[model samples]
Target: MALVFKSLRCPHCQQPIDKPLLKQHGLLQAFLKRKPFPCPHCQEQAVLPEKYETLISIGILTAVILAPLLLVWEVSFVDSKLLFGLGAALAIAGLITQKLDKA
Candidate 1:
């Protein structure tokens, strides 16, 4: 969905957060820790909330599980592969743009 790829905004400056920095922070770390990291735009402490992290994790898991099933259901190999790649891209975007909580 379009909403999944929406860019995360900095709470302080309202600028879009950098994707690379969020990727470096990682989905696993964001899910497990509530630690504040500096915002790339405003340099203020920002945290990825547990709820958003959990949702992203679930979305990724769902995509991973269902994409393979598409192949089993007699979908064309190329179509299924494309769907899988799209699902993965969307999942990564969700992780990169996960909403931040004020810290």
Candidate 2:
């Protein structure tokens, strides 16, 4: 069986904590069960980060990369409308992924 260590300690206070997890079981417990993890040393509490909630950073980064590429293609071509399609697609994707990330 694989060992699973779930908690950590505050460096200064030596308080045990629910250290960051990629997909924490902390979510179900904190919200559903009403058992928010408390620090052993201090009253400080926390929640899973927004960036850690889902995998959207990659999509945003991809949009960033493709945005420039589309712009370059548009600049290099005679038919600028081709660039328009590409830019519109990238912008839509970026807006969508950004909303997803916020949620």
TM-score of each: 0.44, 0.24
Q: Model 2: C-alpha RMSD to truth?
A: 11.2
- Give the top-scoring candidate (lDDT): 1
Clashing residue pairs found in predicted model 2: none
Global CA lDDT computed for model 1:
0.64
Q: Model 1 reaches what TM-score against the true structure?
A: 0.44
TM-score of 2: 0.24
Residue-level lDDT of model 2, residues 1-103, one tens digit each, is: 1111344343445544443431253443552232343333453443333332123444444445554665676655444455445555654554343211001
Evaluated against the true structure, the overall lDDT of model 2 is 0.39
Model 1 misplaced regions, further than 4 Å:
1-7, 21-34, 66-97
For residue 57, model 2's alpha carbon misses the true position, in angstroms, by 2.7
